[model samples]
Target: MINQSELENSKEVGIITDISDKELHLALGLSDPTCNNEISQQDQNESTHDTSNSTAPSEPQLFFQAVGLVRGQYLPSTEKLGSGILLLDDGVIAPTNLLASAVYTVKKHPNLLESPQVWIVYPRVQVKNPPFLNFAIRGARLPLEGEDAEVINQSVDDFSIRGIVTYTNRKAGNFVIKVYRNFMPWKEQEGTKYKPHIFTITGVLPSEGLPCGQFWDLKVKRVADQLVLEDATFITQVFEPKKPKKGRSKRQGQKRKAKRNQSNPQ
Candidate 1:
């Protein structure tokens, strides 16, 4: 299960380009053509007999993109260097599971021009466990720099994101990747420079997090499926973007990993 308590301390990935929705959907596995229509006749009868059936369909296991992509590598978080990997925080009440800092590349589509199409420029926290997390969405633009992403003080209108289920290897040990919906232009936006600013997201704004964003009592729903993750609530910070520090000289960028390690800890 994707840990729900370590969002503030998880490893992150950043892509320096724009992505498309269709590609995202295909990547997230939402476009899988296979469907299990075969069902026992007796079970089907029972399903019809009971109208108030509250039992949820079986939840599929999900694989994170980073884990699937990175081999013989490690992920770091603010809390501990590659520790409690499975104990991820759900970005609520406290930011214990999300990325502490990151420099991702994102952008909006030209069609959605009037609506501020913002490329999410922050760390992309790869969800290691899907069963542990529920209700995922992608493509909802987090307001651009100089544009307030605040849900308070009437900052901006309510927003919706696009999500694509890329990989669903729910075979007991398989996981999936829900890509950023409509994420093609991201490639084009590479080197499309802009000022980097801080993005502060209260745990509450995220529905999956405990004490999630209460700004508008935002109701979260899966874009493609109704297979909801555990529906609990808590409060925590998800992503807090800050202005990117000025570039350091090549020497600084090329600092030895050993020196950086000294500052990190044993």
Candidate 2:
């Protein structure tokens, strides 16, 4: 739901280092190449850039879109003054300077966390040696209501998410969903026996709307990173306890009363 207008102002654009058919097929769950003929045709037409002469081959650059839950703004310790921390989608706790701007933006606008459906735009450049993906948030914003979904979908190069909705501001037109690393098992003291050890890729939708407690399954896709509402479903609902109001605890009140009685000696 990122507004089209905002994308123009975005500073960082994503890059696709590798778009091989096999990779695309695995990522998008496409059974036939004909389904994504546009991407395949484009790939076939473009000649591979030779990197031996240059520092690195210039790859296709596009905006990468992802829905992330803003766990919270990280405040670095005194020793690491400028460094910042960001808990991104899939429980990946990133404590680095790369997300410094994103962290500052979130801190400046605390409201972003309220509707934690944060739209992250970054370059998806793959590092050669370590085989790690290095991403930097170029821009981010809360999705607007009645925004053009088609425009947002077309701009991004890739999109993948699996998480639970932490917050929802339907009036503002967005909801927060969190993602977890794959193969991470679900841990619970009581429900361990019933649920599977690892999370399921697909889930069932019991009701309508992206409720706060619902666990979403957003994996299946014909085109890489193009999300379809019909394909998105919910696995189950999670009921979280309401946070207690800030104040003195019952134990503290009792201790205060005891201190008063001791001083008064009535």
Best by the TM-score measure: 2
Which residue segments of model 1 deviate by more than 4 Å? Answer: 1-91, 96-162, 173-175, 181-266
lDDT of each: 0.26, 0.38
Q: What TM-score goes with each of the models? A: 0.18, 0.25
lDDT of 2 by residue, 21-122 (tens): 333323333233223223354543452343231112122111112332232233444675345444444444444343677667766865654542344533
Best by lDDT: 2
lDDT for 252 in candidate 2 is 88
lDDT of 1 by residue, 90-171 (tens): 2221111212221111122324323222221212232344332221112234445787545321322222222222111122
In candidate 2, position 35 carries an lDDT of 35
Model 2, residue 12: displacement in angstroms? Answer: 33
